[model samples]
Target: MIPMPARIIAVCNQKGGVGKTTLVTGLAEVYTQMMGKKVLVIDADPQYNTTSALGLSGPEFTLNDVLYGDESNNQKIFPGVAADAVLEVGEDWQSPNHSELGLIASERNLASRERDSMMAREHRLRIALKGVAEEYDIVLIDCPPSLGLLTVNALTAATHALLVSEPRVASVEGLAEIVTTIAEVQENLNEDIDIVGVVVNKVRKGRKDQDVWIEKIRTDFGELVLDPLLPDRELFAKAQAAAKPLKSFGSEAKVLRADLEQLARAIWKGSEA
Candidate 1:
């Protein structure tokens, strides 16, 4: 059913501080460390939080150059070999907890892509992925917190999406708006694309506002919601600061690791269906 090379999932939310990048990094580790699958993470966000979270600085040819640079000559910045633009992370890289991860990093120049007058700008990402299709079992794109050209490009390239959101009224509205965009992209760009699941991140206990919106999200999206909800935890910050996953934090991260593993399996299983 699913066309292959990899199951590409765009971990996206057009709202900041919603744990979008964290989900991408977490799932990357889960697929690599836990499931023993290779993962290629596309840091499509100009903010490059995913690139930072993975403990990597910007590389020579980031997604920006691959997509928007001098394309009249070569298809990618790495000349004839596109996968060369994809850099593999070492076990010692940022004290990596998962070595089965490769990255198409992003940098500040990606922001300039929006102002580009190039044609079929949104299709560039899809083209780049195809160039290196044989290299990974899964691809995760961390989209920027906006429905801009970069996000649209990721959506067009992805087979499914994990829409992240905080549990709030505004967040619910954001989910609806993103779903609308997904529908449009499906109709016009990538018909096989879909929002496979909704991740309710940054959930706070005992907050009446959060409780109300959590119920609202479940009611509106129903079975699309994937659990268990990622709690607001301090270890997340510590792990990112250490350039490692919460699971790499050892015993204290048991609960965090379990939650992410569950979510990751849910995503892969959904892709199968």
Candidate 2:
């Protein structure tokens, strides 16, 4: 029997283009392929970048329908395109047109629903997701680049949060804001909510400035900073354009693969703790 993986992790950072969607999608793939776990990704961002990166588009039914409208009817829940439709990255770093994975696509229309709803009902995403909590081994929520209703709902629903940051002063500053927000959410909204750790992405090794910022973040956050930083890689951008993940690309460079794998294990073990 597959052990029940009931952890819900939210990848959040108040800064856009900081690899939030990329990390979530990549980690989902790792969890499925490496750990033999079923993972569900909830793209809560209006950009739908995660949805697109996962090769899901033209959504008929999305999280919006579940949160704002109604998914009480079985027919109303639309499973996204077949997994084989997703682009795949090969071992030679070649691109292919197939994958064996799953994703719950998101739509830009979700923003409109947020605007129409009152503040209290903003937690609809959290409430809606609770219904399917047991369906998958893990659920990853990709939050928007702001502390809005969408982000709050993600934080409230998540058992833990992974604050992704780039090795830059601005990105670290943005992480601070997210940390503060998580504290607020834990105190008032979800007492069980805790920060899993901070993931420093796009890290350039041996750079003096990058090392400085990284050390500062470690000093400030201490054990909250996860080791094995995700290095900046051009392949990631290429995979995104082709709508595939890095691991699919088949490049077995030890550093990048090890970092991501370690990240997945860290999250899993942290949840267990």
lDDT winner: 1
**Which window of ten consecutive residues has the lowest lDDT sum in model 1?**
90-99
Q: Against the true structure, whose TM-score is highest? A: 1
TM-score of 1: 0.91
List runs of model 1 lying over 4 Å from the truth. Answer: 1-3, 71-82, 90-99
> Local error of candidate 1 at 122, Å?
1.3
lDDT tens digits by residue: candidate 1, 1-273: 554557889888777778887888888878888888888889999988888888788588888877765667643333224475788663433323444678888999899887765667777778767747556788899988888889898999888988999997777788888898899999989999978899999888898989989999899889999999899998887777777776667899988889999999999999873
Which pairs in model 1 have colliding backbones? none
